[model samples]
Target: MRPATDLAAGRPAAPAPGPDLPLDGLLRRAAAVAPDRVAIRTPLGDTSYADLDAEVDTAAGALTAAVGRTGAVVGVVASLDVPFVVAYYGAVRAGHPVAVVNPLMGDDALVHALGTAEVAAVVAPPRVAERLELLRPRLPKLGGVITAERLPTGLLPPGERGPAADLDAVACIQFTSGTTGAPKAVRLTHRNLVANAAQIAAVHGLDGDSVTVNHLPLYHPMHLNSAVYAAATQVLCPDSAPTAAVTAANRHRATHLYSLPVRLAALAADPGLGELRLDTVRAVLSGGSALLPAQARALSDQFGVPVVQGYGLAETSPLTHCERPADPRPGSVGRPVPGTDCRVVDVAGRFALPTGERGEIQVRGPQLMAGYLHEDGPATDPDGWFSTGDIGYQEADGHLFLVDRLKDVFKHENWLVSPTEIEQVLIRHPAVLDCAVADHPDPSAGAVAHAFVVLAPDAGPLDGPNGPAAFVNGRLPYYQHIRHLDVVDRIPRSPNGKILRRTLREAAAAAPTDRPPGDPT
Candidate 1:
């Protein structure tokens, strides 16, 4: 058996000091240290570190041979499966910068992502492969489409090239959905990904002995890279059912459970939750969106485990801060992880603000992305601070609180309004199942709050405007009040549970505004 150092092909002969290794380099070190230990556990089967490493080598070699060289951009249709993880690292090891495409994206959005990243090839599931096959003629630069289940099988020759990664090399391009325009690709370097993975491991207390149960609809690189970097075992839970999480955790004695806010909220509201016991679970981590304070509390009290939340964007390797298990906060996203600096800036994106002052949150860290793909947008300043378009504030103790998105905040007369704040207040109503708040343009006031709400099951219809509208109006200030209420069957949300405020705002602009029932102005 060769030492891990011997595997280094294009880089220095000796391993670099600290956790500066490229993304795939972390896998090599894990395989070398714990060859026979299990690295991934899926419903289909379990894969050991040694076998996983060998398979990655085979996949990388095959991809390189098919593409004819390194640095070929590949689009990976991310799914909640082991193959997604394998292909992601394999492509990186083969020196291809992968574009993590959301399989559920609409046709137009998918085309935009594939074209922007200039992907030479696409790897997708059987169903998605068929869709890509139909659109192959549209993508002129697309070399081919490979099914995730059928990743070419062949080992590289003894003299074939191996992972030749540099710190500045682009590892992956993450497409972030913008509120105003099409989704933009976030270009992250090997250094950014590797550093963020290490930071996640440190803050999450992930180690070789830790086992994580992932209950997400798609395979997120943040979870994959961080778990691999820590040499921790990952159990993939494909089902969204809340009870499925308990079964998987207890079956594997999992230490951590990772999921999105939507699923966590459902889990907290599950009627049969009290029947299940999660003795091995230590923490429930939520990301992608803010977890409702009530939902977090309900789950924590029911399961005897801390239900925590974290904050970050695609440009920051997807994880900058996470709540510590020992000191969990219900509403706050906790402080920044090691090596990350966070501060609030004024709305103009300049002049640092005082503590508790709401403004745009900017982060500077080794984990920040190199830049955005295709678009000539300024992702970071000369000082390396990336303005997260999100409106938030940091406490004197450093805990971060997210308010709203910069584009979503609107001016209502003399006051700036956050739709998120009104949405949170409305969801507290027992009859409201889900709701979204958007700015409704007005002639008198610059804008007024409009709410699109989904009522709870079997809930009776309320009087025209006096029901939820009056209920919410009575609780909020004049400028913050929801002037118009639209009853809808459902609220539009992105796949990851973020409210599509832009969609609602557009609808509000086109629809006629109804006068309040009581007509009190």
Candidate 2:
């Protein structure tokens, strides 16, 4: 293992936990500190910390009765509702690791994730529970499907709580988005979750006085855990519309706005954006994917707040880097959070690269997962470094700039081409609303850049003399230029808003060879 000093210069060493708490301990601490504070505010109703904590206890008892075993894997269809929050913490409180199942997943993906996690029981919304019942035959190990609505009705005496002292025990199982490949279940321990919650809270400057607006389709545990750890108020905005989220944030006096890049892009392009007022918003945070710098600048310019982006994978408890809310760099995801170390390594994974040199980004941090589910060992090197499979570079001041996915970067002849580089330039074109780039197979150049673009509602003809292809090509080197451009209605993305590049790549490869570049389909 390399010594701590051998890592980045300004990076701090991981902090020693004075008294590590279990995953449920965060909620307990919050409720104890501020019992009457509104921990969660939803359009349905507001849940105070005291009420939320008490509800979690009741749910824990119900889960204990349903599973009837310690260390069982309990699946929770993670929806953006109070029931999901209750069931998630309740499962962990009842001595079971909660497997977070995305409510929007297809039947095959849903079965695969739950089955792979060895889920013995599930807590889900009524609709999702019904769906799970239909798939019960395929999931042999699943013993019960309890609707979240029925959690309070099921009466049972509370069993002994989970081993709260065992911080190293698995607390949650999060599935990867599988944009590049099959989704794998990532095992996060209690320590990993708790530490990351603290890291996120500190980096994002959350405290008891803070109010966060979760403008997402699903209730991400990172937002939930961090808010609970900081004893801050979280407002769940079920409405997917950006304007509605802004209204909710204003209504609740939100200090932080958490959203996906896709939605933020829409918000930036919304003609009504100028009419919205975010007087209390401290920062507009984009995650799950990169937000185009153009969109970020647009939002920042109009809203008068820093529109910052962050980077992380499910394996790292979903948070390792966040832009410092105070002094955010426009394009960089900022530096690693306290106690986290980030370095760029050569593509071959042999040697580390110097500052400002792009390579595979690797991270070493306490918040990293123990390993993937059913994996042999920890998903880290002998030195505790885990390859992030991302291409990025760190500035001398420690700000990290993402280039593109290592797996997504392809070669144009002898030179490497980054689709993100081309996409960034394409997005700058006034007519382009959104765009995605992929490698299209070529007879000579091994591969060339192909772009799929979504045009603005008011966009002029894109195939004219000064079109998107000509616009982007002029800005990029010959090897990195877009050789084929198709104007599509929308770019395919995952539920989390990550571009479905593999799908685009396949589409690009299968495209008719005779179609001319910059042709709108």
Best by lDDT: 2
The alpha-carbon lDDT assigned to residue 202 of candidate 2 equals 88
Clashes in each model (backbone N, CA, C under 3 Å)? 0, 0
Off by over 4 Å in 1: 1-18, 153-159, 464-466, 514-521
Q: For candidate 1, lDDT tens digit of each residue in 1-521?
A: 11111111112212211387888889989999988889999989999888787778888877777777678898899998878877888899889999999998888888889998999988899999999988888889998898988886445566565656888989999988655568888999989898888888888999999999999999999999998898999999998887898899999999999998999888888988788788899999999998999899988988898998999989899888779999987689997887787877778637677777788888888888888876575778876778888898877667889999999999998898999999888888767899999998888899998888888886654544546667788788989887777889888888999888889999989877567522322
- TM-score, cand. 2 vs. native: 0.94
User: What lDDT does each candidate get?
Assistant: 0.84, 0.87
Structural similarity to truth (TM-score) of each candidate? 0.94, 0.94
* True-structure RMSD, every candidate: 7.6, 2.8
lDDT of 2 by residue, 281-315 (tens): 99999899888787899899999999988889999
